[model samples]
Target: MLEIITNNRKKATLKYVRAFLFFSLILLILFMLFITGVVIYAKSKGAPPLAVPQSTLIYASDDSLIGETHYGEKRYWVPLDEISPAVVEATLSIEDRGFYSHHGFDYKRIVGAILADIKARAKVQGASTITQQYARNLFLTHDKTWHRKITEALYTVRLELNYTKEEILEGYLNTIYYGHGAYGIEAAANYYFGKHAKDLTISEAALLAGIPKGPTHYSPKVNEDGAKNRQQLILSAMVENDYLTKPELETISSQELNYTFGSTKERPVIAPYFQDEVKRLLASKLKLDQETINTSGLRVFTTLDPELQSIAEEQITQTIAKDSEIQVGFIAMDQHTGQVKAMVGGRDYTESPFNRVTQAERQPGSTFKPFLYYAALEKGFTPSTLMRSEVTAFTFDDGRERYVPHNFNNYYANDKITLAQAIALSDNVYAVKTHIFLGQDVLVNTAKKLGITSQLASVPSLALGTSTVKVQDMATAYSTIANGGVKQEPLLIEKVLNHKGEVIYESTPVKKQVLKPEEAFVTTHLLTGIFDEKLNNYTRVTGRTVMDQLTRHYAGKTGTTRTDSWMIGYSPQLVSAVWTGYDRDKTIDLTAEKTYAKEIWASFMEKAHEDLPVLPFRAPEGVVAVQVDPDSGLLATKKCSEKARLTYYVKGTEPTESCIGKAEITNEEAPKEADEEEKKGWFKRIWDWF
Candidate 1:
């Protein structure tokens, strides 16, 4: 019996030991799994967030950042070293008092919070240390679940093991959302104080730090009163933790903050549509993916001049207001470099974003006359070439019917006019006659060579701007003339650099010789006469009187197409184009004024060139100036009326002989005053009086 009892005791002891070993193995496996999860979760965190790209915020040469066109969100990541130390202290004192002493997870605080929750029969508070909160923000969502809590703790431990304390703290401060479309301290500083995080005051820093606790609930945007209350609570916490003395806390709390609750106003709208164009071009031509172009944190240096952009904006706005029906678009470029210096896509970006300067395709109207004359010039037709400006019709086979173009006045003169005279007066009959002389195909070819990329027809009416083209393209075409016949493609962004300051793309202007130097010179000379002599004779207007105050010498053209208005021209220094029409092709109310384009052009040119030196068109090296009859397009004689004709000369290409009696040098004299008085009867006199 004694031996049997001893055997039973030994068997029981063995069984207990076996049970202990199995339980120990299970615990060991669970710990290993937990550690593995922590490692994996830490590696799965999203990247440290960045601010909107610099390209979206274009800056002028003077370092003034232009129009803001940001998407996604505005966040400026700042390192802990860059933040004010007071902000860090204030945040820790309020959000996590034991941040410095605790590890990633604080066991004592967790136990206390749990006990409090049990007593209240509900969860009352959180025990997230600063590092734990940052870990959650970086890796986890705002989920109230045991699994998420466990994951948060694991991520916190992993972060503590891998990163320094300062790095974690910086990550926390920068990754926290502050409501109001702001996602970080830097963004909060900009939104609330209109300044950088580094430049924030102690009060401002404390206020921002108070927000991440409950951004929307305590947001300055939503609950200004709650935000102030939370700010005071932070101040109290700071005092208790010795971050701020009681007296200092009292002083700060009592002071009025005067904070503005919105985005920063430091950046202004210099060029709205231009910036849009830059972004599109960068994404398309450079083959940069959207993420890299918009979020890779690049700095795009553009060719916009804030001064010039401002001038263009002011001109369009003022002109549109004066004539409410006219909505204007303009582009001004440097003739030498093809750099688009200034542009106004519309009167106001917010009012309309059509961006006529780059997108809208309106009829060129008479502004296209230059290209027609250019075609004639290339076909052995000098400015002196004569055409019969009489009414004529042409029939073409377009599967429908023939089209006959007409002059604006709907009347035709059967008399012969020089090519220069035809262009100056903008006579449609003369232009169509010339187009017929040089077949439509040849004219289209010449226009294409002059930088017109718009599709053209083989029909005669195409010479009248039937081919659609953008204002930018038209500006490019005029630039060729201003550049002495070399077409330089317009460029906005000069270069783009990546986040690491490596250049991703650079613009090298493409120069295509479009016209001979002589052809361009002759074009310029003839267009100048339009504004100076013949148009003046017809309306007693002259270039000197149109913008008589301008000290700089320039040549330009004004055009209007029923509902559309345009003014495209060039000086030796700059080439510019301006258009005005309604958003939905509404008719512009020009009243009775004939020179609708001329008004805006004169105002803009005056203001634009106010600070620029008065510079004249630089004649080429071999060019020479000689007096010629602008009316008859020949060498001037004394019989040519000084009022009826003027002089412009091209280098190495002057008239060989004087035009003694080339053609009528003056307008057909109107009926004599005595004859009109005699012809008027009693009824006519009564109608005149009435």
Candidate 2:
């Protein structure tokens, strides 16, 4: 009986063991299937692009914020190489000690957290590893719910499967949210220390590492003691992880740190007009896509000089009346490189989004005469070339139509005058005679060669700037003349960098020889005649209003029309263009409106050159500067001391007149107007331009 009972008990025990082992196998299979399904679902979802999109950032030449394109906000992404190694050690020690060993989820940590939760009878401890926390920060909200936890588990698995450990860490470091609208490690570093992440010391890195746990409560800006305590905790953890010694932690904790206190504040849009131009050029010049310009996180290092921009704006504000409806378009450029340093599109950007500099096309008025004069110079016309300045009508198209041009205020010399005298007086009749003599198409072609892109009609009025041109194009055209006949396309952006800090584009200075160097210098010299009162004939030279205030020599022209007033000028180092007029072609009847351009140009040039060394317009090779009588264009002598002026000419095109007194502006001795060909004869006379 005892043996039978022993056998039955043995059988019972064996049966119970078999049942337990079978149940364990079934449970393992179910668990495996559940994990497989979770992975399949995660794969179906894939990863919604890991990077948060940001718009391109624009910076001035000095690396300050000029403006941004679209919706980028303040977050900055830096590679792991740029991040401080101490930040990594501190974060790993405190946030996830088993980060490297864990695949995605930490089961051991989960079990421990569960035991702790049961002990407190409340859900308190978290089992998130670095990977899990990254997944949650990127994709989900931090709420205590089983549904959220399951979703987080799927994301963490996806991150681990898709990216490597280093990549995951980089993404986490870049995308994690810190306090006070600081989003990434780079931005946080800039905000707190006014420095880059790569420059952070171990102590600074520890302080930053502590912020993510409780951003508001432990932010040094908000709670100094809390931030200090949290930093100490992270440093102690670093010691435990063998990343640092206890003594090192104590020393770091005691070290004093300086905070920047001022950084990443709300930036006002600077050079709004220039920013618009950068966008347009980025598309047209570089072939950058509109979408990329808006969201590629490009770091556009532009050529904007903030000090000059401020001066330009101030000049406009001070010159134009506060209540005036006149609009202004201005641009300042480096003559040598064509880098646009400053620009103001309108008086108020908010009131008018239209960019007058690049968008508006208006008549150039007398400013157009420079091209005509330059063309004449190339055709063997000298500064002493004689032109009869008087009211004259010319017949063209078989004498079917007559076009007569008039000077400002209908003033004229009504006698034989030199080219320099005609330019100084802005004599319209002489300009028309020269325009007619040059076959009407010469001035148009010359303007195009100088970089004017706007359409120009090859008509007699084209010599007078009747056809419209953009201000930027006008500046570029003059830059060619200012740089001694070399064309330089405008440069708004010096270099462009993509989100990964890879150079995408760089400026190469579009330079090409266009005008004859000697002839160009003569033309540039003629521009100064507008400011020289000694060249004054029937009327004051156009720029004489600001002549006394000008401390240095400048090559410039002033254009006046029924609607538009223009001032475009250049020094050896800088070129500036200013346009002021009504937006809708209303006649600019106000004297203030007409003088606004000149005043602004004068003020801007003087203040902009405050710290710059005085640079003279050096004469190029094959060019000769001669002191001549302003009215006769003859070589200067002691007898013509007060009236003599320095003039530039092509080596062979200079005047051969002896040191003799020329005819003065007197109604008594003035000669009658000469015929068309005779009016433009090459001889001794004066030249002046408005």
Candidate 3:
């Protein structure tokens, strides 16, 4: 009976052994087939299906960092040589102890992880080695499902078969994600330690290595205690792997490392609106693919002046009442090169991301008259040409309709006014008559020739700038005038380079001599008359309100509508345009809101030109400045009024005669002895400018 029982036990043990051997052989065959299929697919497809995404960095013209643009993952790629050895060792120890030894997976480790998952009744434990984890990150998602698991396994086998172990490791280090918009070890090191990846110490390396397990939990900025706990585990793993000694581990454990994020230090974008415009230009004007801009790791060198950009932002915030709902758009450009130097969309980017300078289109008001007057110059009208600025209704469209233009407060000169006086006063009636006499097509064609792309109706009101236009386009047209009538497109980026520092796109200015240099000089001189009180007639000059705030010479124009107030001006070096009003075009009634544009423009232009030389506007050849009487429009002589003004004109266009000598001089019309000295002082200032 005892022999029979023992024989029964032996048969039972043999049956269990047979079943285990059969299953093991089937599993081994299946694994071999999977590896073969993965190798075939990897070879046929060339590289892995995943491409390492890259980040783009933007720099100011001074070669200082401004900001960066990226997709969801912001990665700054670095080679294996750029990474610290401590970081590599620490990462290997904590992430995959047998990374160098295993092909891509560790079978024994997989078994242990499976057992642990089964014990916990959850899919928490993962047996992904460094290569496996990297393969999963590059090729698959983190979802805990059978489909993703199989895909990850396939990619792991493919990576081990096709790439060298070093290559796989380098890619893994570059593709790993850290918290706070940083991906890859280099960006993480710079973000957390304020240093480069190659400069990280052992403690920082260990701390960074532990972040991959759970970025939310192990990030030092979020949870320092949890990060420290995981850092200790990383250190212990390094010790066990022979990367560090027990004594060194203890020393590192007690050491406190400084985290850049833990302090008050912050690195916000220096120029948000400027960088945004750069992005738009890259995609829209340069015809670069948006995807390529966000991922090709472009290095964009722009024309932004950081100091001027700061001043512009400060002016907008400080000049406007903070609690008011008014919005503002401003732009400053290098008139010579057509390079945009500074820009601000609205008061704050956080509150409104809409790019007003580039996107918003509102009525430009009388600011559009420069193009009209420029067109008049292109035609035969000189600065001294006379027109009447009186109230009149014009019949257009074959005299079927009437368009009556009104001046501010219904005030009119009710007499003859020169084209120069008209521009200085922004007289609507004079502008309309000039617009009509020159034929409406001439102004429209002239504006289009300069830079204005917005549609013009060719109606009578077109002279008064009734058409809605972009502030940037208006700036571009004025830049052409400021550049002595040389037309060129506005540019934001100077050059763009690929990740390899190879130039991809470069700007070559295509300037066209659209207007005569002499005519442009005369027009610019006419604009300067706006600030001179000598040109005052029925009303003060449009720029008179803010002229006292200026310390240097400037040629500018002010435009006002029921909803928009504009100030556009330029010196010899820079050109700026400013607009202030409600966003929804509501009527602006406050006296303060009405004057915000000119005040901001005056203060900003002064601060902007403080460091620049006090250079006068250059007068081109054939353009001569002649002293004349404002009332008579003739050469200034003792027979003229007490005030004598210098006005610019083309060589042949100057008045050929002097004012008729007054038979009798009265005290009211004649200057007192002291007033004569004071008048000389004012004329001397103008003489010194020449």
Candidate 4:
């Protein structure tokens, strides 16, 4: 009976062993099939293109490279032979010991890592080889998930099968990111040592190799001690791997490494103000955030003219007063296309990044007069219309306050002056009178149509430029007049190209007709009177200092408040605005000193128009010029003096009555006009008298 039991146990043991063997074979076959399927899928998908972050180039209108925008990773690709062998050996020793022998993974290291993780009850160690790291950097994110790991494994197999060891290492070296806005070994070498990768010493190579593990924590700029310790650890690993002898390691470790830091001074950015504006416009146009703009590898083509921009910067530096604590904002735009060619947000961009051109809102002073005068023109008031320039007080509806308006010098004309003379002299009383004569809402609507978007007060002071507005908006509003009644949106970027140089976006000017051609011409004609020597007598005129510098026909206005000074002018082709003031709204005595705004504007405009053709302001149809009396705004007769100036007027609004000076004022027919004026209300009588 005992022998029978032994035989049965042996038979059962053999059967159980056979069953275990069969099950193990099936499991192995399934695993092999799963790997085969993954490989097939990866092969069908093909290797992903290397997507290392690259620097975005910004080109000017002339196609010259002006600036570069980049994410934290700035890379320059190079071949394997271009890298030093010392770096390759050091990297291999510290990162993957069995890189040369492994197919796609190291099972021994993976098993050891798994055991260590199990003992620690957390994933404290990683067993990723160089191939795995390359796979992750190439095609996967650093997300800790089984799905990502499986995908990484598949990509690793694909990498190993598709490229040789040297090719893989070259790609790995080119794709790894270093710190301080550097990616790839070549960029890292140049950024840190100011040399090529092939010229690196063994110590430098080991130091660079140690940085790929943790770029921020091991950066020599951040922690020199930590970087040196990590470098020593890499060197010891190289010694253990037989890649370096002990004596060689000791000699290399003893040598001090020289490093160069990346700074703006080293790589100067050209047209920084314009570049920043382009970035902001690009963000809005593409609906992208700052991070995406820095990293998406876009090629931005801007409307900036490098020569013009340089001229603008130089002129600002030369014209701004040295002893003043005032800041300035300036911008130039093409009249027709509204392309912003040059912009200086402040006197010094490095001192403050606030873009005053497009960002800051300040009182525009007398610059708001043009819009009010334009509103008057729309209300059938000709440039030849006469208004009183004497002191006028406007009482509020509640009778709580009264605004008494006066001229800059407190010296009113004390007589009726033509509308053109009011603008030329910048008479605040006439402006306030016109603002009250025309509806307040009419002025606001005209301002809005002309591109003044800031909040405006609807009081009589609105005509005196009491509203705050951006310098850029002022440029646009003046550009409308320069463009002959057409309003075009301000444009900064011309086009945006993708990484492959394909045009992804192109900008076309958005235009709208906001005024009658005749009306705009009349307004522009009125503005030109400010620079007229006959009208100004070359004295006390706001822009009189720069009038001699103009070689072509241009119209402009000078605006001043207690804290601000502005000069906005434009030719047929270009429009520019210059604003000078203290940033903290400190009171400035613009009347006590020479106007820097006009000086800067004149300097920049003179330099900007040097090579361009001298274009004249073309008169549109339905506009007529008539010689009018300066005092009476009536037709010039032989009795009128030589001061009668030829002024532009709409076809039907030209003065018909002749100016006979005091004789006609006291004529026998004056009693009929007085009897008719006495029958009207005070407002109607004032309106009809003008």
lDDT for 59 in candidate 4 is: 88
- Which scores higher on lDDT, 1 or 3? 3
Task: Provide the clashing-pair count of each candidate structure.
Answer: 2, 14, 0, 0
Estimated TM-score per prediction? 0.76, 0.84, 0.79, 0.73
- Give lDDT tens digits, candidate 4, residues 94-208: 8898999998799999999999999999988788999999989887889999999988988898888777888788888887877887878988998889888999999999999
Tell me the spans in candidate 3 whose CA falls farther than 4 Å from its real position. Answer: 1-41, 49-59, 62-75, 78-85, 92-129, 142-167, 179-182, 194-199, 214-226, 229-253, 260-279, 282-301, 495-509, 638-642, 661-690
Task: List the lowest-lDDT window of 10 residues for candidate 3.
Answer: 681-690
- lDDT, residue 612, model 1: 73
Candidate 2's displacement at residue 78, Å, is 2.4
Model 4 lDDT on a 0 to 1 scale:
0.84
Give the Cα lDDT of each candidate. Answer: 0.72, 0.85, 0.86, 0.84
Best by lDDT: 3
lDDT of 2 by residue, 1-690 (tens): 999999999999999999999998899899999889877876887764675645578999999877766553457778999899988898888888888888987889999999999999998898888888888888788887999998888889888877888988888888777777677788788878888888989899988999998888988999988988888888999999999998887889899988874455445679998998899889987898898888667889999999999999988988898989999999999988889999999999999989999999999998888989999998878898777787887788888988888888888887778889878778888888888877888888999998898999877778788999999999998999998899988889999998878898988876799999888888999998888888898888999888887998798999999999999998887999999999999999988788999999999999998888888888899998788877767788776767888888889877776564444435543454333435663542323221
Candidate 4 residues lying further than 4 Å off, grouped into runs, are 1-35, 41-50, 76-136, 139-153, 157-181, 184-265, 398-400, 537-539, 590-594, 637-641, 661-685, 688-690
lDDT of 1: 0.72
lDDT, candidate 1, 1-690, per-residue tens: 999999998999989888888888888898899778766766676333323242234556566667443465665556677788878887888878877777677788899999999999998977889888887777778888999988777777777767777877887877788887776687788788887788877677788888888887987778888988988888888889888899998899887786777645654566878887888888888887776666555667889988888877776666555646566778989988899988778776888877888888887777777887776666666666656666667666653665667765565556666666666667777777667667778877877777777787767777677666788988888888888889888888888766445777888888888777766777786777556555332222224336564556677766667777667777777788877676676766555333545666777777777777777666665455665665455676776646345444444445676764535433433345557777899976642321
Over all chains combined, what TM-score does candidate 3 have?
0.79
Question: In model 4, which range of ten residues has the least summed lDDT?
Answer: 533-542
